[model samples]
Target: MPPPEPGDVINYIYLFAHEAAAGRDEGVKERPVLVIASDAMGVAVVPITTKGEARSSRSDRIPDPVARAMGLPRAGESHVVVNDVNDFDWRGHDVIDLKTGSFLYGRCPPTYFQKIVRAVQASAALITDRR
Candidate 1:
């Protein structure tokens, strides 16, 4: 099948804030990320991190099956870091462009993407106060 699009999964290099301090040089290397949205500008993504020591409102463990479907590395277990979400431009970042064969990872199903979106929404709402 074709690779990830909007509402799909992808392998991404999530650069740390400190790493990007000087420029987009250092980063955590390859990690799994969910494609929440995409446009002419770039893609809005949610990263899946291996750090599970602490659970936050913006993080959730991804199901094994979903991870497998998404072709995520270390698919057995992982957590999606929603609060760390960011948009990356195609030109400025090293992304897996399926059309150009830039990177050769696969994409997740829409059902799984929907689940991730819901989790992100829930996390976003968790910080809101009705009072």
Candidate 2:
């Protein structure tokens, strides 16, 4: 199997977030979710490469410097660390990250790659069971 494009990752994560939001009556039908542990525990399936080489071909989100300059404060003072596309343009197999602790992937602290992987893996079970 081949790897997923960055946009696919973003879109799927968005899809999972929408599903989870509707499930919780959170009125968040159209946006990235700020999953809180205190609320219903939901895992978001996301993709992550261990290196910074594949981003060169990715055409997703714009540069962070520009985003910050444009006053893009994350929801409720939250933040995300995006690696340079130039640096991560074609890296390794995507790894699922954990969601409850600190994570440092290639100098970027995403903190939830493995958890997303586990969540997605669990979801994949239904497909497996059908086999």
Candidate 3:
């Protein structure tokens, strides 16, 4: 499969801040992440979780329509935690394959991606740099 581009939603083992602070080197489980940026250096992604409330300042809710478009399950709402982004090499070891011949769940629409970018920029989210 080709390298993931910005706007792609892919399953990843995203190590959270608390986990890292506790000396845990890995995430607890695989979860979806939004590929906010990708370049020669690596990719920057924000974790998508079902944990945030709507209109939360630290997170941007993924609309049901958009989530469906991205092939996410219809189980519940997902939010992009804009305040915590993870940076790592493209196709890094933390990436997980969903047994679909690719790591990608699907791509977010351009407009929605732009909205996410705006939200991230507006927040004081910490960008955790990792290999």
- Candidate topping lDDT: 3
lDDT of 1 by residue, 1-131 (tens): 33347766666676543344446554557666677776665677777777752334356776888777766667766777655555666433546455445553557677767777776666652211101
Go through the candidates in order and give each one's C-alpha lDDT. 0.60, 0.25, 0.82
Candidate 1 residue spans exceeding 4 A from truth? 1-4, 16-26, 53-57, 96-104, 125-131
Worst 10 residues of 1 by lDDT: 122-131
Supply candidate 3's per-residue lDDT for 9: 92
**Tens-digit lDDT track of model 3 for 45-74:** 988888784233378778888988887864
Off by over 4 Å in 2: 1-110, 125-131
TM-score, predicted candidate 1 vs. hidden true structure: 0.68
Which residue pairs overlap in candidate 3's backbone? none
**lDDT of the structure predicted as candidate 3:** 0.82
Write candidate 2's Cα lDDT for 7-111 as tens digits.
Answer: 222211122222333463222122222211111222222222222223221112324543233233332232322221111112212223224231111211133
- Per-prediction TM-score to the true structure, in the order listed: 0.68, 0.20, 0.88
Residue 43 accuracy (lDDT) in model 2 = 24
- Which has the greatest TM-score? 3
